[model samples]
Target: MAQIAVDSSPKKKNFLRSPYMLTIALLPIILAAWWLATTVTKSVPAILLPTPESVWIAFPRVLGADGFGDQVLRTLTEIAGGFALGASVGFFLGVLLSSSSRLRAAYLPFLSALEAIPTVILAPIIIAWIGFGIEGKILQAAIACFYAVFITTLSGLGLAEPNAVALMKSLRASKWQTMVKLRIPTALPVIFGGLQLGATTAIIGAIVSEFIGATGGLGYLMLRYRSSFDTAAYWVIIFLFLVIGLVVYLTIWYIEKRFVFWRRIEVTRPDLEKQ
Candidate 1:
């Protein structure tokens, strides 16, 4: 499946060049470098970076621990809630503003100012307002997500064919009909592009918000592990972050494949033996 994205050449391709194999190869290669540096050479101390074995053990320990699931659920909820809230608003507002030049001129600068501020900068303020609850993290995530989708929606709606729009107007189509039949379909690909980006952005926002102040969550757990010098546990959280980002990203990508199926173009590269 991974190879399908990378190997588009209409010729015999090296099996070793397959992305699936190359990606899997990263593990042993990294482990070997890590083992050599820490276990063999002692050049990198365990206190700063734990051995792979330690991290391997920590994964099971972390997963099997009581309440670990609760913390993970809290984090996931914050990310999902934030994304849902932000994306919904962004899509609606994008439609509204794009419907009129006056609306865009009236509100675009304010939105631009909000987008200028990073979610990290808002973390402390959000926590203070919401009192370290998951709500604050969700707000942070929402902030992180809003601009990407909004801009993409604007870009997409603007891309509707001029002739098609003129035809709609000539046919006395209502704004809603025009949007449903033409504008939204045109905008979906671009909007989904924003959504794909938001999948990971929401994670960063939630995690950083948790860092500011939180009772539980992966970010809080990492901070706790750091204070206690639990290096392996810290690494486990790092890996969890990576995993969460990838899962969300792939989910959005799959959904995009469905909704925007027309955008996909397969270029066949038949086996050289068959040729």
Candidate 2:
């Protein structure tokens, strides 16, 4: 007699599928699904749930007609400035703490505590103190970004194998030589991790601070749309934010590829298997 059996677990499939390509393919399907649902139900009004076409048409109008272009440009400028400042500070501190045990021990706890504090809550106080300008935004972004890089650098530096250190010492390598040749190279992966985290948070910090007080930005645009109950415009602003975040993320990813070529052999082995 044959026995019936069921396979309960899902099989793991190929990992070579590009998430980017999948997303692009799925976007139109999503829009179609949304359009059908709204049209069939008619439960929600068009004003409240404007179709994708409406959003597309309205998007360009915001460029000049409503000062959307200028707002976006200003916001991008602020984000770039803030991210640069944060990344610089984070990288420096990371290197410092990695090299100095005393500094890491003394400051790691403080850094952890600072990270626990809610950045959103700090926005009002920062605005009050710094008067709602670029300085406040820059400071906020820098602080948010600092700990990630610091910890990553610390861990990466620590990851230097003892044998490697011993070999360097036996070779009478100078402190600078040891650091440049061995410690720093071993820590590159961790440093890159910190950099990616810092870069993403920098964008978040700038946008959040702008939400608290600013006359420009995608965040500010979101605020205005919220006040007037223009959900469509709010959605558009949100989409723009997603795009900006993606851009920053890709930038960091590109940097990682440039710096961590050694990791690629391992990372892309799945592609080899698929092919």
Candidate 3:
């Protein structure tokens, strides 16, 4: 007689799944929706609402060698340059303000005033001062990005609990030592939040500047296509904006995941823990 064997192992599901797989799964559904809308619709004219295939075909013309690729490159360069300058300056100022009460009180009002100024409205003035080249775009992006990082960093600097700071002082830690050992780590989540916000705003700032006056970029490309009534190409430029925003958000998200991994607050479910 054969004996039955018993096996016991925990059944586990992976929650950290790849986003690419999800995108692939949704592709078919999206295609079906697009096909039905374009093929079976008398609700609207085709010229007003073109098919997904038309948009897809136009994408190559918009992004290919003869199209908007060079423009995209120029925009990327301006955004990157601007964001780097803004984030660096903001981070340093944030650290300084956090460490000194006098400095915080002295400069915070000025910072707030800077933020209150609508940078987008000043595009023409910026162009007048810096010209329509990369400089104006960089300045625009930098100013917007500065506010994002600055505000977030200020919040992060104060996020540490009072008790934690007291304990550090009780241990006879120097101000700098306490900052490095306790405060900065506690601020990681908040700082990362600022970085994400800044990165996103940088893109918007760059695009807005490009729109005001640009020789190249999706903004310029859209303008060219619109003048010629190439609405398909116009839509393609809009698609490029969506892609650029998604890419910027994702890149910062990846960086946050890497640096702030240790800062996660673990939530324990009583029922699960009891089991």
Candidate whose TM-score is highest: 1
- C-alpha lDDT of all candidate models, in order: 0.87, 0.77, 0.80
* Candidate 2 TM-score over all chains jointly: 0.83
- Could you tell me the TM-score of candidate 3? 0.81
TM-score of each: 0.88, 0.83, 0.81
The clash count for each model shown is: 0, 0, 0
- Write down the lDDT that model 3 would get: 0.80
* Model 3 Cα lDDT, one tens digit per residue, 1-275: 56422222233544445557798789899878767877566454556666777788888777784845678888899889889988988888887898988998999999989888776797889999978898888888998898878877877878888888999999999989988888778887888888888988888888888888887877777788878877777878787788888888899888887887654422123433354
Compute the lDDT of residue 224 as modeled in candidate 2: 80
TM-score of model 1 relative to the true fold? 0.88
Q: Worst 10-residue stretch by lDDT in candidate 3?
A: 264-273
Instruction: Rank candidates by TM-score, best first.
Output: 1, 2, 3
Q: In lDDT terms, which candidate is top?
A: 1
Better of 1 and 2 by TM-score: 1
